[model samples]
Target: MPIISKQHGNTLLITLVILILFSILGLSLLSISISGMSKNEIREDNIQSQDLSEKGIDRITHQINSELTKKIEENNGLTRTNFINLLNSTVNKYKCTSGGSIADSNGKTGSYNACIKEVNPTFEKNKPTVENELRKSIVFESKGKSGDSTKILLTEIEIGAESAPETLKYAVGTNINDKDGIQDGEGNLYLHGGVSVKGDFKVDGNIITRNFGYAYLNGEQWIQSLLPESIPSDGSTNSKLVLGKDSYRLTTNTGYNNHIDRNTFTGSTYSRTTDMKNLFSGEKVPKIVQRDPVISPIGITDQKANFFLISGEYYSTGVNKIPISNVNKSSSKIIPTYTERTRECVRGFLICFEYKNVDTEKESGSFEMNGTNRFNQFSTIGSLELTNSNSTFTKGLYVGGNLQIGNNNTTYNSNNYSDITLDGPIYVKGNVNIQGANLKSNVLLYVEGEVKIQYSTINGKPLTDGKQGSLIIFSKGQIKISNNSVNQDNPSQIKGFFYSEQDLEIYGVGSNIRIEGGISARRIVLNAIRGRASDKLFTGATKINSNDYFEGEVGQKTRESRLQIIYDQEIIETFSNLKQPEPIIYKVEPPLVKERKI
Candidate 1:
């Protein structure tokens, strides 16, 4: 019995030893699982942080581009107010990086950090600043980097004044040297009479002359701003500043008789407004009126749609008739399409085309130059119909006739030294250096974008008439004029609005009132500058400062578009990812012992 008892006690001891071993294994497995879970959480946070950093950079760049575009449009192309608004709203914020956390488009939070530095930049301001003078820049580092996170944004801006030319000669006369096709080394050009230039004219530099000069620049043309208005928001058939009726204003009737398929018609959509008002508003649906049945210059279309009629010259108050019958005897009354083959060179020259006689051929409708000289000329014995036809002077374009410029920038030269009439408006997309001639138009002499000139013999007199200056600078976009006049001998006193998105700089002398979006200059030579068209001549600098001016802060907390936002630097919530850590399982094995006879 005692021996039996001893064996049982030994078995009991063995059972207790097995239980201890199992407990140890289970604890080890639990520890490993916990460690794995912690590591997984860290990894997930790292990925999210990286993603948030990238999005932050994108958001900032978007704001910058938006502000720039808005300013250019609202202020007629980047006025002082727009500049100030952009700087204060965007650049003033933490540019390079900040220690605070920035939320991304996904509403994810990540720490923002960046290196900030102001780099010197030579930038030109679209307008004069509150402190009148040439523009200065505020350049800063536009990139950021951290361990595995990186972000970048590059931008620059400036403000300053450019000197205006003092004298401009030969604003009127006849047959002198045709400076239209001259090179930059020939010095600033001036023309005043009937002119003709034959060559591949190229003005490698700035070409300046009086706007009243009867002249043209001759070259392979690269006219940019043909029609520079916003597409109409209202559903209208017209794409320009004006809309026409059922019949194309310039055609006998807006119709398609050509055998070509309808698919052949390709052109940019023109709108009377760009406000997006046609979407759901009570705006009337626009009936399409073919303005350009065929597009040539710039290849926007295949042919000229219809002839634009000058209200005062061609269309009488009683009945408006399509003049196609006038050209039926010569060729197709339809206007020919002249595609622009000019290289995308930034510079070009100008030339003038004049019909030798117009009295006898007044009833004619179409005129074309078939000559093949480097520069070609077409003349008529009477008042010929140069209408409903397209002409492209390989160089600059000059017109002096009852001419009409299409919504497109055609390369046709106008007959200089004649009473010029325009059915539509004259579009000066490139340089418009008029020497001397009366310019009459129906709508606006839209530049579409920029305007640079050398001199002005506007009205062949001073701008003191109409109780103001002689010239008017107007636009739906922006305007820029640089005086390159060299004839300082008798600098004509000037008047007009140095109107633009920015300030106007006038560097000449005389009596005049000036209206400008902004004014900037190092030395105004008060005798040469003026303010309001009614304000007395500015004998000195007429400096005015905006009451709502703000500069950008390179590293600070600022609101975007004046909206409130919070800047924080800590994580507000934490989470654990169990799936990220592979499960840690425990295993048990039976211990082996020999059952021996006791």
Candidate 2:
């Protein structure tokens, strides 16, 4: 009985040890299962965070593309401020919760924020490069967080260059869509007498030709010409001109038997046949549109005016003129000096004129020539008439009304002591009558009304010499050059860019007219033919006809007039930096993801 008792005790001890081993094994298995579950959760969270980050980037990109499409359709450009506003608005749409957390549609709780890192733009020759060559890149970064997982995405977007405004691209452009033929007839563009254009020629309506009426273009010529009697099929000798939805007309009332130098007519000519549509499917009529800038007037006080002349109305009679000693001084109130302020005000406005109605009889003023005077920039709300004045304008001039330089028979001769130098641009809202004056190099004149140049000298020296100058004249109305002649001794001669929205007429009995610039107009008329011997020089029919008859015989002794215009390629840059179209997002970089342990 004692031996059996001892063996039972031993067996009980072994059983207890086995039970302990089993408990240890069970605890180890439980721990392994929990570890696997935790790892799986971590992996799923990481994926969710990554997907949230990618979705955030995609959403921002879509928003940007949509906005850009709208801007492009509206012909608007995206500025830096506009881009920042877009990002801020997008962030607000995907608002986070009170604890700075939000759940996506996929039921994953995460937070995302985006910011702009950089915006860089590249330029060429001081002008924006072509769309393909333009370099405008932006960097965007997005961060997303979900539970203990966080993901970051970085992206880069390249924006395409903005195209130039159509109005600025053409040497002569108008927005007249004269459905009725009345306005169209008066607004017809005319070309004649060795006229040349260095850039494209665009007109909104019909085009008319006068005697020897031909336009020489270094670029393209877009005209809505009248259709010919019969259209020709494709032939080597056949006219390369295509019939559009418009018609063409000759000044002589003749047919389309006009001659064009092969070298000058490198571009295709299109005319409209019916209903203002191109007969040839591939032919296109370049349209001329209008664009106006916002006018914000700057306010001036007595103190400000004392430093720089700023006035709503300016009048000078006799030998009185605005003195130049007052300009570019220090202002007592403004933080910046008056010179700095004046530069800032006029820097954006090379030329500016605002039209305002004034009593011509009461407000008409003139500046008489007496002594030499200097001015930085001059602007007026009314007409500006200069009579025998020797003035030097260093910057620019703007007149709300007419700009008359000299009177009839008043010769403007520049001597060593007495000279008039217009160094910058001139803007006139009304008529421009320049009887005799000397325009320095790189001078530009823009008129909103009629332009009459009786006698003038442009660029008193040759282009080879550093003293040579260039001139550009733009007119919204008719342009008439009567009895005008260039300098005889100057190699630079008269280089002029004469552009008219309406008719460009040149009338001379025997005087020689030589212009080294270009001429772009709606209708160009040249009446250089000598007056008939039998015809009376003076006509007694009407008042308007009497002046024409008197001036007719004044230049009759010469018997012939020589008109020449040679296109200059250097003036092309003068019209650069105009308004441009909106930019486009061309390329988008793939989103880069980075995981962070939180």
Candidate 3:
């Protein structure tokens, strides 16, 4: 600090001031850069967290679904409870989330947390969602952490359930592909004799209608009330059961899902278009009543007069069967349709009747009935034949062998028509044959063998009453309902429940095959063709469908369809009490899945 000129001093002071200003500006810029970097880091973390969350959930769901499919295939099937147990075993959104070891987008590591919970099902209101197990759902959630930032994603998976319509609820529910691994027309159905179903008709395989099958699903209203209500419409397909025109030719192809054969089909493939369940869904249909060891009063010749079947009284057979005849005692030969089963009562009708004293024909230890008494819960160990007219059977009957009803010697008429009346819950362990005028019933026939019905009128309660009234037949073998040579202008009402593990066939010519209830079989054949029918009414030149005819759908009694099916609550309730083999669970359909950010 020696000698200084005034001008030089001023210049030095100015220089010092400029330096101070530059220093302040540099400090400010440094502070700003640090703040910006910190903010950017937070933003990057948030973005990565979201991405990780998304990826984590996707992987988790994909893994779970894949595992589920594998399990079902491995186990053949898994009950709802079992499925849930498996779902719970998927702990820690994959093991990577366990120790904060999951890879982040920035090559960093982060942890994820996940959870699953069962929630109330979201089903449509006022709709009949039967056997859906309350339409429950499982909510899945996962959170990904990145740089202290977390993102959560959630998804809901809903499973669907249903009882096999043919087994209990529907007029017809058939799984034709049960016997064969393929679905090549094995489950096809043909409607004939103007035969129609008045209820819902479901075929799990396919319908092989040559002349075309008619089924009137009540259009929009019907769809709204029925199952289609829950399924979304794919604009490409109509909601009706399209009886494809090329099936007769298609039966030759021995394969499943031959899309080329039914490519033009515009029918509903059910609600889940996105994910259709596998037909080999590892589940079996529910049985009506299994042949278990139960008490019955039908046989047991050792218990004489021990149990009196009073009129309108319920009785058990105590694991035996009732002999239908007293003359042969061990014989029953009342047959025209099921004559092949004739053995014990093989004597001439008159010869057997000679020793038949209806009054004092009681055996020492046999279950006996006097006069025209009515009884329920009767069992027959052998063949049971009914030639008596205007006969009525109530409640339940178990036939361990064959059962033949109606007079094979005479045709049924309004006045001459033999009426063998019956109510619900009957089990026939053998074949069944009946030839009558009005085969009416409010019953369920669970036949272990074939069933043949020559002439039938209306049976049981009428559906117009808007109540549960009709007949339901579930056969383990083939079923046939047709007209005899004497049938003409019968214009019969073929309503009730018909199900066959094999083919369910209905042959009609002269009669308007108008059927209510339901008909279900592996293959349903309705032949209303007039090829063999003549235009004659009981020798009076009765009316017959002399040529090919199409009234409406293949299985309806009136209106649009030749066949239709209506639901019945009474029948469903009946199944709840029926004898079961084991704890039953219907098949589980693939779930509808949805996801979103939480």
Candidate 4:
């Protein structure tokens, strides 16, 4: 009985020890599970906090950007002073001390604070501040927070004028309204070859150019509102651009019969307008002040001189008059005789023939020159024609009546080659016709009436000597260029700035032509259709040149126009010479973003 009792006691002791061990193992497992759950909660909080901070940044950025866009739209452009004011207004309205909190329905929350400052800018006190000493930037700071996460963001927006685009720097372009291309076509433009233009053309007409050459077209102010990657909203067919073939490609090899393929028909889709309109609007042409001659020749005042030599120092419209009416024996023309005998009439060899009598009633006594001639300073009241080739005029010519220039001069000695040379300013009141003349000189032709040029080599100085003044033609009436390369000895180039209050026209001959310079006009017409017409095709009033290149025909795809344009800086820089108002320009840079975590 004593032995059985001892075994039972041992079993009871083992059971007590086993129960204590099981309790310890269960307690350890429960502790491990609780620690894992706490770690998961911390990870979830971190993700939510980071997202909230980013959301804070996005909200503030969007709001500020919206305000900037609105201000720009209202003012066309924001000046430096105006921009600072805007930034201050925005900062006051939205900025917060510490931070402003934002909570979402999902229990995610964020806080944001904003501040703005200018970066390294110097401006004159109380002055209009036309120029900026150093490029300025608007820097923005945003402090974003959510839960335990915080992020500081810095954004920089640059301010100042940007370099003008290649298209906007053309020496030639049309100056008209933006919607005119849609509403009226008043600002129509047509060009080919290496074409470039300023930022004012609104033409909807199909422009033509070569496949390889560049077509640079800068649209109007409002047209630039759309992003570069976006197209016009209306999506009209007229807005589409079509470029012509390089006539030089098959120039001699193909004739009217053998033409180019249809694949060469390319379109101009990369037209870029600028924010410059909002920034700067050029002033209109100033009023012209009439300038009178310095001295009047005593004896020749009674009779109206056809071609005269005036002697004296002069201003814009100087008249020291002498009539060499019967100088040339060939035709009944008045050619200005340049001799030491006639050169004595006026000082500085200044000559004026009836300059002040430009009234329409006094349009009689037209002057004509039939042979080659050369003269110094000259001005006339009646119409004058340089009929024969190789005529040279130094200084300038101010005419009151119609002038016919550059008749036929095939052979002439020039470093870059020219049949006619007008080495100075040309001012005329009546229509001026330049026919079949290769002109080589620096010309600033300002005409009150229409100016027509055909088969001419205008401003074709050699590249080395091209520093001469550009060929600037400003006409109150329409300006037309046609059939330039009828005889394709030269390229029939017209370089420099061309402006017309009315329409501008360019016609395609069998050969190619190039125009370099800034051009501004109401509208443009590019007629690439080619055909031949006999002398009997027109009436007696229309003078017929047997070698006329643009008689007109139904334009076929194979036979197209070849044209090009380049260089515009000279136009913008020298437009004041035409008594035009100046333009102010600026540009906006992409924002630079920097971020930091705390």
TM value for model 4: 0.40
| lDDT digits (tens) for residues 267-292 of candidate 3 | 44311121111110112211122221
Best by TM-score: 3
Candidate order, TM-score descending: 3, 2, 4, 1
The alpha-carbon lDDT assigned to residue 525 of candidate 3 equals: 54
lDDT of 2 by residue, 150-192 (tens): 8876666554332222333333333343333334234344443
TM-score of each: 0.25, 0.45, 0.51, 0.40
Clashing pairs counted in every model? 79, 22, 68, 24
lDDT of 3 at 215: 21
What are the per-residue Cα lDDT tens digits for candidate 1 across 1-598? 8999999999999998888888887788888888878766666655555554444444444455455555544543332333444544444454444432233333334444322234233322222333322222433233333334444533343322111110000110011112344211122111111111111111111111111111012311111101111122224242221111111101111121120111122233211232322211123222232231111011101101111111111211111221222111121112121113211221232111111212322333222222111212122111122222333222112122222222122211222212222222132323233322222222223232444433222221212233221233322232333222222222222322222321122322111211211121111101121111111223322212221111122111121111000111110000001000111111111111112110
A best-first ranking of the candidates according to their lDDT comes to: 3, 4, 2, 1
Query: lDDT for each of the candidates?
Result: 0.25, 0.43, 0.44, 0.43
Candidate 3 TM-score to native: 0.51
| Between candidates 1 and 3, the TM-score winner | 3
lDDT of 4 by residue, 297-406 (tens): 11111112212324332222122232332221222122232233434445564443322222222333555544455545455556777643444445446576787777
Best by lDDT: 3
Off by over 4 Å in 1: 1-7, 79-598
Q: What is the C-alpha RMSD of each candidate to the true structure, in Å?
A: 29.9, 17.0, 14.1, 17.3
lDDT-wise, the better of 2 and 3 is: 3
Q: Which stretches of candidate 3 lie over 4 Å from their true place?
A: 1-112, 116-149, 152-157, 165-185, 191-380, 385-397, 405-410, 417-421, 437-440, 462-466, 484-496, 529-583, 592-597
Which candidate, 2 or 4, has the higher TM-score?
A: 2
